[model samples]
Target: MTEPAGRPPAFRIADLIVAEGPEGAERILIAGLTVTVSAGEIVAVLADDTGSAAALIQVLAGRRRAQYGAIDAGGAGRSRRIRPSLPAGVSVVAAHERCPDGPAHVVVVDATGTRPAESGAKPAHAAARRGGAVLLVTTDAEVAASADRTVHLNRAPRPERRPKAAVRFTTQALREAAAGSLTAAGVDAERAALVARVLVDADVRGHFSHGVGLLPMYLDRLRQGGIDPTAEPEWSQEEGSVVRLDARGGFGQVAADLAAERCAERAARTGLAAVAVRGNNHVGMLAAYREHFVRHGVVGLVLNVSGPSVAAPGAGRPTLGNDAVCMVVPRAGGSPLVVDFATGTVASGKIRHAAHRGERVPANWLVDREGRPTTDPEELDRGGAVPVFGGYKGLGVAVITEVLAGILAGGTVSPLVHKQRAEPERAMDCSQLFLALSPDAFGNPPVEELLDVLSGAVAAGYPQGPPEVHLPEQQERLAETMAAEHGVPVPASVVEQLGWGAVRTAPATAGGTA
Candidate 1:
């Protein structure tokens, strides 16, 4: 039986070959045996010899490498060999061994000499009943008959091609298209333009995860009532140098803009001001909000909290969100110094992007539901979580972010915040904290002198001259400059999904790599 319409195969082995003996004199035991197993289906591989079946099983278990071909398990990208440890959701059961106790999505059973095939077939069927696929390698005729489908070892098939290249669009064209798409989805024209600007700005700075790639998600949220485009951020409370704003489930970009503006205005009078925003949705990128402070000539510090996607140290499950922190300092005679990052090893969006492109990620970036290190990007959707960047130190920063953005702002935290992508119909109810400090309050300290001293320290530290020591925001500025001259490149899949294919331009050679 075939899998459900929109579902991908549980595992697929294409053009796989098993060989034995010396280098050139090696003999092909199993030549290009292709097998595709759908979820909840039992597939039997009928091999000519016991050695061939054993070899194939070894390859599947990651104990031996295949001579050729690719394996894709659980839609995690194709690879020539499985990692030292098998991919997530896959398990191997040896002949005469009982099936493992836990829940595995795919089970590979070696039943080469099982009698009557009833014992082997029974366990395979049981595994399928639990919503898992079973691959039974056996020469027994009964075993082949019991399977949902059978593959012969002699059949060889071709491998599929990789994903297509990204489509390119000029910055103006992409911003216009993104704004139009948002406006069509019920966002006000002004808000749509603002949102578009923030997203495109992130893209030009080489932050694709927060760039135009989020337009589709924002549009979805607009349609589902997760984001209230018509609502405006309003000051809810005020004190000497502290204020609170309620977004009322409005777009995060709008909330962030208003908060930054208010903070800067209040700081001008009070020397330092803090603004807390509650009931906001996903803020594209914190750096984008720094522009408001930059224009107002104030130093800015921003923090935001979201639903949990990062695991705390020594914990198996996610205990905190991969919250973000950003600070921007306007220099006297140069570009602003901006530092922005998530507390986790990587942002959750990076893994999501990898999954969208059918690519694998580094094992250290994520842990499966059982807390096992995995390279499968899809594991994020299966209860996996990203770990803190530098272990305990990063965890400390993340906790501080939660306290400032969630607790102090009186907004929903971790388990309380609805997932933006998973539950688009519901509001995220995340929070943000914005702080503005005026250098004029301190009689205008010599910021340029401080920067020069830092540069000099870098030179002195490395007698041979530091290997291109980069100041904060230096790389981002260079990327943005190049993107302005050339065009922004977006994934073809994303453009097609957003119906902006018509705006695509020729690929550009300049600009930061994606």
Candidate 2:
């Protein structure tokens, strides 16, 4: 492997160390690279700090497992071990690739100077210039000057993972965190634990969108005076099979959980139940909420309408909300079936995440200066909008969501909400609707039997095209199995952004057969 001309040869060797549960293994992969990093040398990663990257860095550093690949850092008994802390003189900076408003500076890690302060910028810049090594992560055009060296880390060629034990612990930790959030907010003992369990379930099911990644949002909102942890959702009756709720600015997860459970309970009594909820903030993972009904042998449908950020189909002008829809169906075996997708080609938060990681997005997913197709995420902050998929068809569905969840639920529409938006917290007054149905309630026959018959028919009547039709949520369910066996495969951007190290522990053969 080619080594950068700074560190000793012993520091540069080809190897791979994948993290695992209980313990990890190593392998000597001729394909892996061991670059020599040194003091005052800048190492830049040209990608976002997404989950995939986060997990990879952990694996590479021997903190996590490797499904395949190994590391050999130097002369050692087993190359699978990590020092837990980096050696002296190494510093990590998530520049996010965008131009710094002024000189580069040390952002104080404390609450008082938390984000950035004007006075600290000069000192931070001077320190870097004085030969303190700085690791800057950013997209292509965002860097104002040449880096000492730049390393490009891209997304995994395909979705992948590591050990079963490590995966379980990670999932369990997330569940405990979720439970802690509720308990701290004064949720009852039993309810808080249940809520935490579902949150962890979301992570194990490979639904990172609603996983531990959302903890900061909860903590931030609570710390920033945006959400009320003590608040509760008060229920009110709407039309037949429909209910209305006021979440009173409480935790979005709590509101969603309550709404979904209530809808499922109603559906068990009646043939169907629909509930609309308003005044809540970010509902962690809709899949977790929907799964509540699915576990009870009920089919659940939910549509979430959020603040204005999406553009009108074909027009490129901001109009409707970036509407999202989620559905869950009970399955007898394996993981439960659930489907969740944003109507926009991509969510705005994802764009913000890309900006934070100093990465560029695919050109197709964004709009240009004149509201044409462009990949730069910065435009989004300056009145640019993300286009809707499937043209008018998708826009039509978003419109339906607005009427059902926003208007009917007594929440502000996109335009009005966007007009009054002063801060990020204020931008989230959107609404959501949950529809639950007990298959057995509608008919005397059991729900699982019908689902099985329908599932078999869907499998038998496959499309001639490449994509197969198993139920709507079956594909994700199967992916869950693999993810459970290994750990969640994080994006490469996440790993490099974290500035950790890795090694190769498994033997030099696949399947540990060496």
Candidate 3:
């Protein structure tokens, strides 16, 4: 399509992190990059990582998830996050090669770092005059330099890998090892097994941060009686399509599992059900609960609030929990579409892992006590906080979780949930919200066909990575298979945390006897 002649489209691009790739293998496509285009200007975004640049363009133009900015009370800037599914009529301009084509509110100019700057800059200039913004996403510095305004997205370089052999254990042995650790920590038979399964399940699914690595945290909390070892969940409300549960300071997973069970049962009957949970310890990962409903042929949403460890935009304090959210929907013949993430740019566990390994964290992930950005993981221990992902975008999601899971569940929100200088204590009053819905509740159309179509459309794009889309559920399935077939690889760090005390901290693959 030729460039249109009119005034530029009024749009502002801020630091956003809506980009997604293969699980665990994801890298920063764009760092804290912000670009703003006024009434008659063309902004060229240049980044070393083209993947991030393209993803950013798609998300802004409503090609990806439709939410932008922080989860503040009023509304985050310029963007909005949609739950479950994108609205009808929502379409992403399909990209050809690395360039996008077709009609869109914003037009893209794909100039591959080659050619004289004037060749492509002329049309973009013409488009802006016609009241349409031309987004030139290029790696060519010259092309970027010629735009009316140029934004340099300082994307962090991918973390360098220190190759070490993986340490493997039979799936059965891995389960036992995890369960044994909990049991040794004084957890009862059933309880230990339940928690162990979740931890191992996370590792099995490649979410090591939420997996066995958290065992020490659980043990510490339970040992100190910070979490009541035998506490039981009691239903506080069981009204139609809505319920509330008090966890009684017990293991977070137990209450979460119960909530998922009850919600799925109620949703099947009522078509929609919600359960507000309060007074539980840390729930490892919400994915376990969300996927449960998917197995029951429904959609599930889990929002959890914990200690305030996330910094909000414009706030001088770390007043928000990295509050987590997970959503799962059946993909018909394939894996469930499990979307799970915390509001933080990176999980706190990862920072701890970096500290343990003497590795530098990505700059955007941490801010020290002085409120300055840092790459040192040790800053976390010295009173640093995980920054909200994409600034306002992440805070907005955290706010949603804060309201639904904390306040609505009768628990404390952010600033109140955590004290700045207080010593670490087991968070016993954290809250969670579980919502489940029958697919038929909306339109009752053929879900299998709908998903198949969507899945096919994604496949048509030939996205990178194994199994293409890398749906969380799909990743979990693959992880489970690998665990069963090749055994689970327990990191040396995890082994050390398990009280083994002297295991080497390098990766070495090992397996139980055949």
Best by TM-score: 1
Clashing pairs in 1: none
Alpha-carbon shift of residue 488 in model 1 (angstroms): 1.1
Q: In candidate 3, what are the lDDT values of residues 1-514, reduced to their tens digit?
A: 2222453334444444443443323444444454545444567767666665566555544556522231111112443233323223122222322534221122343222122223245656665565444556666677677677666665445654453444676655666777887777777889888887777677777676677777776777766667677888999888866799999888888888999988887887789999998877777877866556866788888888777777877443466777888888876666777888888877777777666555566656777786655666788777788878766776777778788888887567755553212423555577888988897788787877777787677666654633633344666777767666666676666576676543222223433321
CA lDDT of each prediction against the hidden true structure: 0.75, 0.54, 0.64
Question: Which residue ranges in model 3 land beyond 4 Å of their true spot?
Answer: 1-166, 314-317, 418-426, 459-478, 501-514
* Candidate 2 per-residue lDDT over residues 1-514, each given as its tens digit: 2334654322222222222221101121111222343333444434443333344444433355443222332212233223543333232222221245533212111111122223233333443454444333334424413555655444344442321211123344445545666566566666567656664555566555455444445455566556666676888665687889887776676778888988887887787898888887767567777656865667888988776778876566777677778878776775556677777767666665455444455544566445654445677777778788667898888888788777887566656543222353442565789998887776656656766777677666766633543456655665565555444433334323322124122222212111
Model 2: how far residue 509 lies from native, Å = 14
Q: How well does each candidate superpose onto the true structure, as a TM-score?
A: 0.68, 0.56, 0.64
How much is the lDDT of residue 65 in candidate 3? Answer: 53
Q: In order, what is each prediction's RMSD in angstroms?
A: 13.2, 19.0, 11.6
Q: Best candidate, lDDT-wise? A: 1
